[model samples]
Target: MTQKRLTPTQFRNQLLAVMDKKHHWAWPQFAGSAISKAQLKIHFQQEYGVYVRDFPVLLARIHGTNPPMDVRRKLAENIFEEDTGKLSLGKSHPELFLTMMAGLGFQNGAFGNLTLLPASRRYRTWLDQATLNRIWLVGTAVMTIFVEGSINDRQELLHPSKARSKREIESHIKRHPLVRFHGLSPAYMDLSRAHQLVENGHRHDAYDMVVNHTTTRQDQETILTALRKSLRLWLVYRDGIARACRLTP
Candidate 1:
């Protein structure tokens, strides 16, 4: 029996359903309240090693698969901004992250050599294989939809950042835990600023690439399975970080 292919909208809804669960219980502790500098350093180190540092390379792995012209173009644009930040800021996202960390008194070298927690390494190892999967759509969905798309993805798609004024944006950035608690000054928040600037189009582009370019029922199922795995692994990964941070939740 032939399976019915899902419409782009339907597949996207399912993907968003998975993303909605991206939140960890301890996230509120980490984001909403204050934590020690040690805790914050540990958390950001795991994060940098896991994804922040090599995200562009991960995207490039997907692009190297050569899925389609449109897909390639979208991936290229994402890679360009993440690696160069030319379209938004003048530094790479990872560099900007280190700059933000500097405001918290973390040296750039602090992020250069760090060990991943057990669960963190497990999740990262999965990313290694998944992003290099033979079926490009599996890699694409895992990275574009699951990795890049956040829990607020639905809101991002519906409202977009254009609705927010620059003041409103800066206000939100000022409220970040790093700024409010760790004393990371808003002046060093160019990473957050860069995200706000480029994210309006990038979020929509990520959805368009995954939702519209997918062409098969099998590919649809494959992508969904990959995303589900990503969600599970990511949850465990976040749990490990929370434990490292001595967070109860």
Candidate 2:
């Protein structure tokens, strides 16, 4: 008998389990005092070459391109509210990206030259094909469910003060003009609060549960593959907008 395909939620849960397990192993390899605000700022300026303040404009430019109405509208709202409003902490400190990038050790110029990772490339290529073929909703699913969902997770992790020095970080983020506007949005706040609940529930020790439940190398690979697929789907999302705008050469 053929096995039943998992629902999206079920699939996501499985993927999270794998990530949680990986996080335990990966965290130690990457963690250090080097993941500091000052280092993050230096890394961002030298490597990414784009400040957090500029992110909204980039997003706006992409969103402004004519696309399917729903996709355009969602991107517009998310970009505007995120870049301009209370959540706009990204714009204010600009260093947050540095902090994040530093944590991931993604500062190498070599990384910039790459279009996408092996897993992400396939997913993006698929999305581009789907979008060009007019499978618009499929493209949107790649964006809203996976790409945006990942950002939401990262934001939740960063927002709450896990460190004793969180107040310093919060102050820097809060003082930014864009972040001020971000906080004003009720929808954004609501979504943030909900995500916070999830993050809070997943204690560091929860990795034990994740490992025990997943139980096998095959299961671990399956979850990793799914995450990679989701990331690739996000590239399709970006390209879809580009296509809609007739921006692609």
Candidate 3:
């Protein structure tokens, strides 16, 4: 039997629903915990550096002939901001957070390496391929729509809680000069900014992948499955980070 095809919007909405559910289940477990925050900061610091280093490579892939000039420029700007911001974090925070994690008896390779898990590796690989193929808009959708939305939903889940957890969160947020300075507040704010920018049609070039492609039932299903798997994997990573930090109940 042939499967019915979904529009891009339909595929996106289905992925969003799955991400929302996972975020609801995972955020509260980590948000307020001091240990969790510490671990998260460490994780973020590691990922941030790796992302910065790879930004140029990702850009090179996107800049090849045949990609729309406007799309290339917009993605270049986004990558610049992201990488430069992260570089600033590394400069200010002298403590090598990932190295510290390794010292703490965490799985040295898994926690130390930026793209340790299958999901993360898949997400990065997809981004590279999408950019190289000049389908970056689809890549942007996956990152901003699905990934950022998932993070925002998780942050919302962390909103209410009074305990050592809450205190720890407050303290970390207050003390981390880098977070406030760099505008790394709750994940919602980041995602919201990206969503608004996309909605305003500022970066339609990035969305060209999904827009120009010939739609088919199989394509729609494949995209949807990739999105769902990416989200679920990240959620699991969040949970593992929390457990590693001893934040789980």
Best by lDDT: 1
* lDDT of candidate 3 over 108-215, digit per residue (tens): 354444544443454556555544544444455555445434433333333522223434545554544334433344421332222222323322332344434527
lDDT scores for all predictions? 0.87, 0.39, 0.46
What TM-score, computed on C-alpha atoms, does each candidate reach?
A: 0.95, 0.34, 0.51
Model 3 worst lDDT run, 10 consecutive residues:
87-96
Worst 10 residues of 2 by lDDT: 21-30
What tens-digit string does per-residue lDDT give for candidate 1 at 125-206?
Answer: 9899998898878888888878887899888887776745789889999888888877778999999898888777777787
Clash count, predicted structure 2: 10
lDDT value, candidate 3, whole model: 0.46
- In the range 108-162, model 2's lDDT, one tens digit per residue, is 3533443433433454445444333332333333333333343334333335435
Candidate 1, superposed: residue stretches over 4 Å from native? 163-165
Error of model 2, residue 198, in angstroms: 16
Off by over 4 Å in 3: 1-4, 22-26, 33-41, 49-70, 84-138, 151-214
Give the local distance difference test score of model 1. 0.87
Total clashing pairs for each candidate:
0, 10, 2
